[model samples]
Target chain A: MYRAQVRVRYFEKKAYDLFLQNLVKGTSHLAIGQEAIAAGVAAALRPDDYVFATYRGHAHAILRGAPMAAVLAELLGRQSGLMAGKGGSMHLTYAAGNFLGSYAIVGAHLTIANGAAWSARYRGTDQVAVAFFGDGATNIGAFHEALNLAATWKLPVLFICENNLYMEYTPIATVTAVARPAADRASAYGLAPIVVDGNDADAVYEVALAAVARARSGEGPSLVEAVTYRHGGHSRADPGKYRPDEEVAEWLAKDPLPRYRERLLASGANPAVLDRIEAEAHDEVEQASLAAQGAPLADPAELERQVFADGGATWRR
Target chain B: MATLTQVATRTVTYREAVALGLAQEMGRDPTVVLIGEDVAAAGGVFKATAGLLERFGPERVRDTPISEQAILGAAMGAAMTGLRPVAELMFADFLSVAHDIVANQVAKARYMTNGQLSVPLVVRFGNGAGLRFGAQHSQSVESWLMAVPGLKVVVPSTPADVVGLLAAAVRDDDPVMFLEEKALYPMNGEVPSGEHVDQLGVARVRRHGKDATIVSLGTMVHRSLEAAAQLATEGVECEVVDLRSLVPLDVTTVAASVTKTGRMFTVEENPRLCGWGAELASIIGEECFYDLDAPVRRITSPHVPVPAAGSLEDAMLPSAERVADVVRRALG
Candidate 1:
């Protein structure tokens, strides 16, 4: 769990650096401080389980086993990228890794996740579909619709809301009616409300394990709200100055990376082993960045490919 | 017509064909599932999907809440995975509520994922005006989907075409928007019994003539044939072409008819602005510019919302008389 969080942190930082160097084009939503939720939830999931994430999904994709180099190459718009530069950072999809997709539209993937779960149940498989979104998504129509459908149909799925307390530039508490966005709405769907500390990896993993087991057993869906924060801006553009300095400082103090390291050391974990993991994570990120930067841009002809299943963009003959 | 196989035939209404088409595909492929509001047990709001629930059972023919986003989104997700889902949008106008799923997620998922996924799904909806249901319930929105790539837009004119084309759409590897004309649901036509399937982009020449070519789709195809029959009594024989599918448009048949006739007219039910006929007119202008003896004409509904009153709607929508009059004037 520590290694996964460290790898996400290192990869996000390198991506931020690359953005500064103007190598990563377009926009990217970084999940620097919210790594524990991704790492923990993924840790409890089997490799074949389906995962649907939002645009801020670099951490989720990496923790779901998408190669770090290919993810970086995708952000860099390289030919060897995860989607051949068709989908940039915001739309990373590694279907082979069971990371179904990172949807850019807010709240849409929740309903789609229900479809995956429905497919699993129909096929007589125990595979659970997990959809990760932000607190703002809980207010969208698709979110409510998805919850209602999943609950009514008893679909095998989990709705994980990373309540970072902010909806883009505004505090979620200001716009939201209830104090807890996702957890507060669980009862409306007859689901048990679950809220966990996003800064604590172990807490998230435990919650995820219970939810996954319940879903696999066909107990319907679960809504889990992970209280976390984003250490960086919402995207590459904003500096996240809308947040109060004291709140930012408080969340930074609760950073999961160093906090986990401290917990491990106090628990009698070897210092050299932790050091090696951290060093290897850093080295992996560095090498991935180098490899992604060295890769060539996608061919211009690829623009007209794969619009349909026939592997062509031809709408008319 | 050339793409269809010889088989036993039975006369059925368009509404009955909708249920028959669904049952045919569901019986053949267990993966094909039907989902929508009132689609099961209640048959359907329009009674087009009657007997589906009892035929396929609740697990396969399930009813959903009045959630358009959930319906299309779940259908898209299921299609992306393994199941071939046929989602009904209830009304085509409701498509506006869940346009993002159709235009963005379903249409672009294959391209965005770089072919890593394929959304093999069909979104069938009740389309066009004629029921006096007013503006909200009536619309011909095929033009709305024609502009969006990565989607196959199919609007069948006859009962046989509905059964056959729906089979084609169900088995298609891409997402398809199957628009069923609400006005023609009660219209009876001969449909083949047993298994029936048709190609997606093949346009059927309903009536062959040489004086002029009249291209139409959905309910307008019947109106155009009526107009052609009327014109035949006036010493003018018009060739009527029914463009069953819009996305993979059968330009070959329409172009050939226009080239032989030396004139063309498009009868459309959609509003005037950016209608499917506009694209067909542009294509005709570009491809058959020199072959034309007269300028192409499009008899369509005025750029106005479909009104509730029958008289207003009849005057607004392009009728058989209007089509024949336009063709006569253009040919003269």
Candidate 2:
């Protein structure tokens, strides 16, 4: 869990640097401070368990076993990218890893996750599907519909809301009706209200494990609100001037990476082991960035490829 | 070789054929499942999916809430993973509510994934203006879906084509929007015994002629055929063609007919602006410019929302009289 969280932090930082250098084209939503939710949930999931993520999904995809280099390549629009540069930074998909695709449109993938779970149940398999979205998604119609359908059908799925206190640039609390957007609505769907400390890896992992176990055991779905914060702005365009300096300082002080490191140290973990893990993560992300930068751009001729199953975008013969 | 006389046929309504088509595919492939609002116990609002619940049981023929987004999204997810799900959007206009899932997600899933994922699913909906259901319930949305790249749009005009095209849509490794004309549900036609699977992007010539060619789709096909029959009495010798699928459009067939007849007219139920007929007219103008004796014409509904009144609704749709009048005037 610590290694995964460290790797995510390094990868996100590298992505930020690459964006500054104009290597990673287009916009990217970074999960710099919300690494623990991804790492912790990833720790509890099996490789075959399906994960549907939002556009801010680099952390989840990487933690779910997508190679950092390939993810960076996708962001860099390289031929060696995850989708051969067809789907850019926002739509990263690694189906083989069961990390479904990251949906750019908000609140759409929630219902899609239910479909995946419905399929698993229909096929009589123990596999579970999990969807990760923000607190803002809870207010969307798709979110409510997905919860209602999943609850009524008793589908084997998990709805994890990464309540990062903000929806894009606006503070979510101001726009939201309920204090706890996702958890507060859990009762409406006949689900237990589960809110976890998103900064704590162990706390998230415990909650995720319980949810996964319940889903796999055919006990129906769970809605978990992981209270986390985003360290950066919504995207590369904004400076996040909307957030007050005091709130930023308070959250930065409670940064999951350093907090986890201190937790590990206090739990009697060897300092050398921790140091090596941190160093390896940094080196790995640097190597990935270098590899992505060196990769060639996707061929222009391949633009029309894969638009249909016949390997062509031919609409008329 | 088996002769045409050796094959047995049974008459069935378009509504019955919808269920028959679904049952055929579900019976053949275990991966095929049906999900829609009131599709299970209620057997669908139009009863187009009647007997599906009893035949396939509750597991395969599942009923969903009035959530179009969830229906399409779930079907897309199932299709990507493993199942070949057939999701119904109830009314064609309701597609607006779930347009993101259709246009952005299901349609682009395979393209975005670069062939890593393919959504082999069919979204069948009741389409066209009729039954006095007002603007929301009645709409010929083929043009709406045809504009999207990754989707295959199919509008079957007859009972037999319904079974055949539905099978084809279910088997195709892409997202197909199967638009069943609500007005043609009770219309009956002979369906041959055994499995029926039709190829996509193929147009069938309902009547062969020499003077002019009449191209149509869905409910308009019947209207065009009626117009052609009326024209035949006046020595017009008009040919009628039914374009089964729009995405994989059968332009070759239409072009050949236009080349032979030296005139082409498209009769459409969709409103005038950017209807499927407009695209066909442009393609015919480009492909058969020299072969054409007269400029291509499109006989379509005027640009207005379908009215609720029976007389106004009838007037809004392109009737046989309107198609015949348009073709007769253009040919002169």
Candidate 3:
């Protein structure tokens, strides 16, 4: 838990701050206030459970299982990065941990989540797949297609909408007729819809646990919408000007990392032990960034490789 | 060691031949699945996957909603996860609708994953004009896909070619864009039974003649073969090579044929400019230069949208007469 909390604590300081610090190679989208949702939902999942995320997936990749360094290395486009520099910030994969992938397309990952869940069901594994997207993605055609298919197929997918209030600079209110919360879309597909306080780690965790359990037990897919915030710009430029400053301050006050830390303290976690864990996670992130920077890249001639199959897995030709 | 007539090869329509290939693959591997709109009950628009849903249940033969993007996205998802998914986009023209997933996702997933992920997916569809689907539907965008780096573009003209290529695409690890000729579906040829695999990126010499080479693909291959037969009566023997895959282009066979024949007449149904024939012409000029006795002539459609009238459609396609005329010009 302390390991996860390092990113959590740093995120509360400022999303833009971490975005700046995590300047690997390209533009970065920091979750800032959105960190709680990953920590929250991640708390409810087993290490073997699968996760598929979107562009704003730094926190998800970290919380799911990828070391901060590897992700940072990936972001930096270093050869030693998670995707071996192939997938920058937008795409990341951890197959061994069942972290399916982090897609940049708005609502693309949900269908993949359905496929993964369907596979899990076919294999007779009790593992549940979670698809994380944003409120903006709710309006995309694929989101509707995925939900309708999942509901009909009864696949074990826990669709999580990180309602960060905006798709880029456009607020959900303007872009989506988010009649109720995004969770209400689930009812149209005959899936149970649940809304949670995304900032509260424990709150999100409990809902995720129940939803994932029901899904794995053949109860079918569920949709959970976590109402959260992104205190930083959507990408590298904007200061999140669309949302009012007062609303930002109000959410910052409810920052869950500190709140969750206080809860852990009150629940008997040692203060000195917490400090040691923070130091370790900090050091780990620094080391990963260095390692990724030093990793080797694909051969340039192979630049033209893998557009087609040379037969099987080998991209050498 | 003569391989005897133990296994009688069966002749089937280009449509049923592909259907047979997919069905055979599905029968052999439980993981091979098919998904598309009306592919289940309607048996595909051209009856390509006819009776497949009945043979394999809806779980294996899926009918996707009218969303082309969804069909491709789901197939990409299924391929990366575990299953070997073959998605049919009813018409090649509809590729524009799902351009994002195909251009960015399916094509780049493997390279982007740096070999960590594999999208063993096949997108099967029909292209080329002549049925009067009008401008919206009648598009031969083979060159567009051929330009994409990671995609393997296979345009099989006959039943046997479709059967063999479909089986190979189902088994290939990379994304295979398998294209069938919209005009040649009813054409029949012999196809082997059970898991038959046709090698990708190799041109098949349909006819062996020395006077000139007629390079063609899909329906044009049939046209070229017909032209060769007609030209035979005129004392002109034309060799025809059916290009199986466009991207991995069997340039070796093409170059060899161009080298042997000296004169070449390439035929195509797409607009004359930037068509696959234009590329093939350019390649022959570059590689098979010194051997050419005369300038390589090409039979192609005029640069315009496919007209609604049947007369115009007939004229737009590279007819046997047109191919024979071009071959005669090249032979001179």
Candidate 4:
């Protein structure tokens, strides 16, 4: 899990460097400080279990088994990208890994996740599906509707809300009605809610495992509100100066990478092993960046292709 | 005319035809399921999905919550994962609340996914205005979906066309917006009984003439035919074309008719500004400019929401009289 977290962090760092160099064309939402949730939650699911995530989904895609080279190539807008440079950073889908896709619109994937879970139930499969969204999505109508439908139909879905306390520039507390938005709303839909320190990978893994088990057993749906923080701006432009420095400093002290690193060392694990894992993660990210740079740009002819599965045969009169 | 009247033995109402198409497709493919609000116990507001619940059971026929977003979003996900879902909205006006799912997700999934995913979902809704259900319930929002690239907008005017087009939509691998004319739901007409299917992009020439070409779709197609019949008495000889599918617009048939007739008049139930009629008129102007003896004419509703009173709605909607007037002016 620590290795996965480090790999995500390293990938984001390289992506940030590429963005600075103007090689990465579009806007990317980095999961730098929030890597633990991706590493932990993804570790709990089986290969066949479907997964959905928000715009900040690089870590989720990587942890769900998307090749790092392809992911980086996607961010760089290359033909070798996961979506052949069409989706860019905001939308990434790896069907082979059962990572359905990610959505740029807030709260859009909740019902989609419910539908996937419903599909599994309809097909008589034991596979459960997970929807990873943000605290901001809880206020959207689709979120409420998804919970209601999931509970009413008893679908096998796990709703994971990454409570980073900020919906873009506005603090979530200012807009949200309750202290814990996801948990408070889960009760209205008759769903048992679980709250955990999202910065801790082990705790998130334990909670996610239980939720996945409950879903697999046909115990309806569950919501897990993970309280965490983002280390960077919402997108690539903003510096997140709106946040108070003292608060930022406080959260920085709880950075999951160093926190886990210290924990591993205090448990009497060899320092050389941790150093090697970190070095390997850095090398893997560096190699992925080099490969992405060498990848070819998407052909212009690709623009007219795949508008519809039938190539819009019926579309052209 | 004598043989045409005899061929009406297997006639059914427009609503029945739509139901038959859905039932037949569901019977043919186990993956086909109906999901919508009140589609199960209530049998839908216009009864377009009548008897489907009992015929297919609750597993295949589902009643979703009163959430358009969830309805379409779930349909998109289900389609990607292997189910051919026919999601219904109570009215076309409700599309405003769920346009994101249609425009962004369902429409762009296959293209954006680079062919890794195919959204074989159908969104069926009650379109156009005649019943005085007011602005919110009564609307012809088909123009809104025409701009979306990956979606196939199908508007069926007749019973035979409805069943055939709907079956084709269900079988297609792309997302389709099956817009059913609310006003024409009760009208009865003959439908081919066994294995009836209409190609998505083909246009049916209702009446062949040489003076002028009259193009329309949905309820407007019947109104255009009525106008054509009236114009025939005056020696105007108007050619009538029913464009069943909007996106896969059969401009070829319409162009051929315009080339023969030397005039074109497009009618639509939606507003004049940027409506489907405007698209047809512009395409005709671009492709068949030299063939026209006069400027292409467009007859459409005024740019306003459907009013509550029947009198106001009558004024807002296009009529056969209006189509006849436009055709006469174009012929001159």
Candidate 5:
């Protein structure tokens, strides 16, 4: 879990640098401080379990065992990326890894996740699907509709809301009516909603593991609201001036990586082991960045190939 | 070379033909599932899915809540993961609620996934504006959907065409919008029995003539045929073409007819500002400019919401007489 968090930090930093250099075009939403939830939730799931996440989902894809090189190549719009450069940062789907999709549209991913779970129930499979979104998505109509459908059908779905306290620049309190969004709506949908400190990766994994078991055992859906914070602005463009400096400092002190390192050290873990783990993650990310830098751009001639599967696409004269 | 083929046929309403087509596809393919409001026990609002729930059971035929976004979103997700889902929106006007899912998710997912994913999903909705169902319930929004690149739109006019085109839509490996004209559901015609799949993007020449060509789709096809018959009495031999498929439009067939007749008339139930009639007129002008003796003409609904009053609604929509008048103008 510590290695996963550190790798995400280093990977996103390089991505930000690449964006500054204009190597990576378009905006990217980075999950710098919210790595613990991604690592912990992913660790709790089986290999075949499906994951549908929001646009800020690089860490989720990486923790789900997507190759870093391909992910970096995707951000660089290279042909060898996860989506063959067609989907940049916002839209990524790793079919083999069971990372169904990372959609930019808020609350849209929830319905698709519910459908995956519904399909699983229809096919009589034990597979469970999870949808990861932010606090802002909870207020969307589709989110409530998905919850209602999942509860009524007893679908094997896990709704994960990483409540970072803010939706873009505005605080959750400003936009939402309820104080605890997920918990307040849980009873209306007749599903158990669990809230946890997202900074503590261990607590998140424990709760998520129990939820996964419940879903696989046909106990229906559950909502897990992990209270975390985003250390950066919504996108790379914003400077995060809207947030109070004191609040930012307080959250920075509660950074998950160093806290996890302290927990590992106090448990009498070898100091060299932690050092080597951190060094290896840095090396891996460095190698991935170099590989992505050398990757080739997508071919323009086949731009219309994937538009339709049957290959009947016609260009207008 | 010439060939003769014979197939068994029976007369049925457009509703029965559509329902039969769905049932046959469901029986043939296990992955095909029906999802919509009142599609299961109630058998759909228009009864287009009548008797399907009893045959397929509740598992395949699901009656979802009145949520268009969820319906379309779930269909997209299910289709991505090996299920060929045929979802229904109660009304074509309600497509606005499922707009993002249909346009952003369903249409773009295949291309965004770089061929790694295929959304073999079909969304069926009732279109056209002659029902006096008001502006919200009635609309011919095919032109709005055609602007979207990844979607294949089909407008079947007759009972036989509905059965054949719907079967083909379910089997097609892409997102297809099957727009059914609400007024034509009770209209009766002969449909071929057993398994039948019509080739999409192929326009059929309904009536052969020599003076002018009349291109139309959905309800307008019948109106064009009627107009052609009326023109025939006045020594104006008009060729009528039924465009069953809208996306991969059969420009070649329309061009051939226009070249032969040297005049063209395109009709649609949608408004004239930016309707499918304008597209047909442009295609004909671009492809058969030199072959045409006169400029192509378009007969379309007025640029206003369909009125609730029956008389006003009748006046707004294009009819056989209006189409014939346009043909006469094109000939002159």
Candidate 6:
């Protein structure tokens, strides 16, 4: 499982970098640091379990088994993307993987996880849903409401907040006046909270295993806050003026992916094997990037297709 | 068409009718389940889902926390996972809280997934201002949802339509917003028992009068029928069309009605400007332009916040008198 995490991490980074390469315009938020949460959560999930994320969702999408080409195409706004380019970065979906969507709205997809969990329980499916959001999302109203509902209903959902400290440059301390860490907000919902080193893939994997187990057993929802930091600014172009130089250096020393690689190499796991894994993932991502560039564009004329359940509204006029 | 009794006659309140539809659907199909605030115990504030908790237990008849967004979103999640979920937004006015989940998640999941995942999910809620539930509680916000893509809005007028639309919503491979008028929960109608899958976009020709067609839905359907009866005695026969579902609009029915009658009027209790009536008027006026003897008229409530006082409510809302007046002017 640990080795699988490293391979997925490499795949995610390679895929994301390739997606960035194919970008015609706009920015991309790379999950370079938060790879463990996706891999760990994916490891704990079954094919029927559902997952949702926000705009910074590439890692989750890739780890959940969305084809590299499909996701890259989405980021590139190509027709072959997960959502056929309709959703772009935020709304990519791989339904067959039980991946519902990557909502653009902050703290928006939690409600979806709650809804799906209730449904799974009703159908007697041991399927659970995983909602991945940023620590910044914890302060949002939907976050509070979603956790409360999940706890109250005992819905099978694992609410994971990748607490990277800042919500688009607004530091966590400024928004949530709560005295302790924001992950403790889960406690108010009467849900058991597990705060782990998000940079450590094994730690995330263990916490995710427990949460997914509880959810599948119909016990209820749980919250897991993976504390990590992003190496770059919130989005592209903004040079992250908010963080002090020392803080960036401090977090860089704790980079999760590199630390995992070092540990694997120290354990005598052949460095060549790790290099081979990187090569394969890198090659796959490069191919996907090429594919994204050549992917089709949605026909401009079919813009109104599938907008409504019965298509666009029609009247006498 | 089918004999009224044979069609499906159940003496059920609108609330009971909807609940029974959900219970029956959930029982018959394991994929179906309930997700809402108080749907499990307290059997919904309207008591539609009474006895659901004990019968289905907590897992199936799930009670969600007071987060409409989460309720709607969870329903989307569950649906994508292959469970057909029926979520209740206790009041239609509260759909605003869960708008993104319903509009973006549940609505677009299937289409975005290239139809790989079908959101067999229904968001059931009550909308209207008659309950004196104050401004926050009494809003017919269905117009907001009708504008969103990938959503099928169903407003059932009769108890029969409630059963039929809801059953179809649960069984159909799509996302449906099922709106019930809060004031009309007690109104009874015949619901033919078997084969309840009524096509959603087909508006019913409730009364087949020839002078002009009055398009209405939910409570307004009853008001239109009453207006039609009163107008009939005055030799001004008015055809009333019940738009059971708003999104998959049976514009064909409205088109045929306007073509035959040469005039059309839209009636609803929702505020006048930018209301569903306005959309209906736009569609009708555009499609049946050559057939119209006069411009389409819309008889709707005044464009103002809902008044809390009962007397003011009646005055502010569209009444049978207003519908008749609109028809009279349209005919002239």
Better of 3 and 5 by DockQ: 5
True contacts kept of each: 0.77, 0.78, 0.41, 0.68, 0.49, 0.58
lDDT at A198, model 5:
92
Each model's TM-score? 0.99, 0.99, 0.92, 0.97, 0.97, 0.92
lDDT for A267 (candidate 4) = 92
The candidates score, on chain A by TM-score, as follows 0.99, 0.99, 0.89, 0.98, 0.97, 0.91
Candidate 2: TM of chain A?
0.99
**What is the C-alpha local distance difference test score of each model?**
0.93, 0.92, 0.79, 0.89, 0.88, 0.78
* Model 6 lDDT tens row, B83-142: 787888988888877777777667776666555566778888888878777778889887
Per-model root-mean-square deviation over C-alphas? 1.1, 1.2, 3.0, 2.1, 1.8, 2.8
Ranking by DockQ: 2, 1, 4, 5, 6, 3
- What's the distance in Å from true for residue B29, model 6? 1.8
Model 2 Cα lDDT, one tens digit per residue, A1-317: 88999999999999999999988888999999999999999999999899999999999889878898999999999999989999988898888899899999999999999999999999999999999999889889999989999999999999999999999999999999999999999999999999999999999999999999999999999999999999999999978999999999999998999999999999999999999998999999999989999999987877999999999999985
Q: Please give the range of 10 consecutive residues that has the lowest summed lDDT in model 4 chain A.
A: A308-317
Maximum-lDDT candidate: 1
lDDT tens digits, residues B1-332, model 1?
A: 32344667889999999999999999999999999999998999989899989988999999999999999999988888899999999899999999989998999898888999889999999999988989999999999999998999999999999999999999999999999999999999989877888899988899999999999999999999999999999999999999999989999999999999989889999899999989999999999999998788888999999999999988998988898888888877
Candidate 5 residue-wise lDDT, A93-161, digit = tens: 788888888999899888888888888777778999999999999999989888888888788999999
Off by over 4 Å in 6: A1-22, A46-48, A216-219, A308-317, B1-10, B193-195, B330-332
- lDDT for each residue of candidate 3 in B247-285, tens digit (9 for 90 to 100): 678888888888898987878878888888788888889
For residues A68-179, what per-residue lDDT tens digits would candidate 1 score against the true structure? 9999999999998999999999888989988889998999999999999999999899999999999999889999999999999999999999999999988999999999
Candidate 2, residue B201: how far the Cα is off, in Å: 1.0
Question: How are the candidates ranked when ordered by lDDT, highest leading?
Answer: 1, 2, 4, 5, 3, 6
Two-chain DockQ for model 5: 0.59
* Winner by TM-score between candidate 6 and candidate 5: 5
What's the lDDT of the predicted structure labeled candidate 5? Answer: 0.88
Model 5 misplacement above 4 A: A315-317, B1-5
**lDDT by residue for model 4 (B119-204), tens:** 89899999989999999998898889998989999999999888889999999999999999999999999887676767788888
Residue A14, model 4, lDDT: 93
